[model samples]
Target: MDKILEAVVMSSYPNNVKQGLVRRVIEAAKQPMDSEQCWSMLELSTKLYLLGDTKYKREIGKEVLEVYGHYHPEEFEEFFNVRFLLSLLQEGYGPLGKRSHYVLDYIQLGLQFVLESPSANSIFGLLRIEVLRKVCERPSPKQCAKISKLLIQHPQCIPVGKHQVLFCQQLIRCIRQFQCVSEGEEDIMEFLEQVNKVSGLLQRIWRTQTSVILPSLKELFTIISSTETRNDLMYLVFLVTNIFIAGAHPCLAEEQEAPSNALASVVQFVPLELMDGVIRNLTNDDSITDVQMMTAIGR
Candidate 1:
């Protein structure tokens, strides 16, 4: 048993470990291995050793950054794997509080890797959106600006995913909400300009045959309308109205406009009375609560 355990440990580190035997051993050990044991194994791995010391860690981090920073599609899977491992380590070290600075350092390193990589802009754009969703439960203006910049710079990078629209909508909603609270009109305007810029890029991508996984115009409209602020409503109206004037389909354009804005425009009109009627009905419904409102918009 002792010899077998030693062999397993030794084999685990060897580059040429027999896949069948390794799999069998790992499966057998799974039930008995506690967190400490698992961590010990991880620590013993070459990957962890590389991650442990500052100089070596930095070198690895630099390599990863180079891969991700340049928009290298070939390195996507490798970067994702490394990022996943780093995230796991970050989570593992969280209970240590301030002592977890090293974990954060590693995370920052991982981020740097993403930031410095060739295909980084898109990857970072996606990552920033995800990070913002969690960090911006109630975001600051700076965070909003940062996210806005990302969206503006790498609009096509945002892949079509279940959460993509929700993240975009949430970010816009948060920026609008922040604007309302702080009366930051300039900030709001800046954000809107970026949003519009990104929207235009998305439109161009939509029109192109060679476009990568860009979000559809309908998806953008869905997100814009789903945001949870009066200001967001106004902005949505503005965006839709502009898109309509740009010669997009009237129906699709009208979908994002506020009832008032839609009614005001002859080019793409919806009746104000009907809009008010819908709003009145929505207001009267107790089931249309705040949570429901967010859920509805998110959908």
Candidate 2:
């Protein structure tokens, strides 16, 4: 019985032949193998089949996932992490008729697994954030707004530190770009509020340091200058200036020094002429137009 099971596990046969052999082995066994033993055999068999033929791997992964799901939800991660799924995604498998739905479902299931596992939640969150960023490449206003809402709703789910700050900055840039293309002022305001809320959360988490906060602020200022809408650009400038002032306020009572360096970083990204223009605007003595803003950046 052990020899037969091993033979079946190691077999490199066509799908029909493999299925027939597996069925025959199951039927001939005097006693049923326990779940773990059965699953182990199945995993080995599936891997063998996948190795024999790359084209059949997705089918094999689907069958393996189904069997694993019957045994335990925890197996979802293992099954979904199969190299086939990643390969399929990289090879643009989604647009291939029925196969695309399978790929999409697998990706969604993988995300759901991540969301449900406490230990894996942050990993999953970062994965989702990356997916969202990819989706933003050519997204509609509606899609961008939806992604922004997801980020805002689960800011704390993202692990703290430089990566989280970088992700948030990317999200903010996406939202600002979406706003620029669509002229969505209300959406932009809502995104800003979300950023402020998340910044507050970071402050609570990383007291006495603006390490996370500074990157986000610099990105926000960059986006404001990048937006071509005259009114929106000026509004964002005003908003950021106010935020900077608030950061510097003595009455704020924070343990850390204000992030003066963050402001300098923002200024560095702005072209020298733009820096001059911004200073002029702050003094309320400049007549810088939108074209001048673009030209100031040598665009």
- Highest TM-score scorer: 2
Candidate 1's residue-wise lDDT over 1-299, tens digit each? 22343355345354345334544544454344344444333333324323434453334334433333333333433434444543543344334332233433434444443444565555555454454454336444444444444444544434345555455444434433332222266654544454344334333333342222222222333333443433223344453556455533212222322222221122122234345654565567675567645533442
lDDT of 2 by residue, 19-104 (tens): 77655654543244455555564455444333434544445444544544444455444544545444544453433432233434
Global lDDT for candidate 1? 0.40
Report clashes for each candidate as comma-separated counts. 15, 0
- C-alpha lDDT (0 to 100) for residue 40 of candidate 1: 36
For model 2, give the 10-residue run with minimal summed lDDT: 250-259
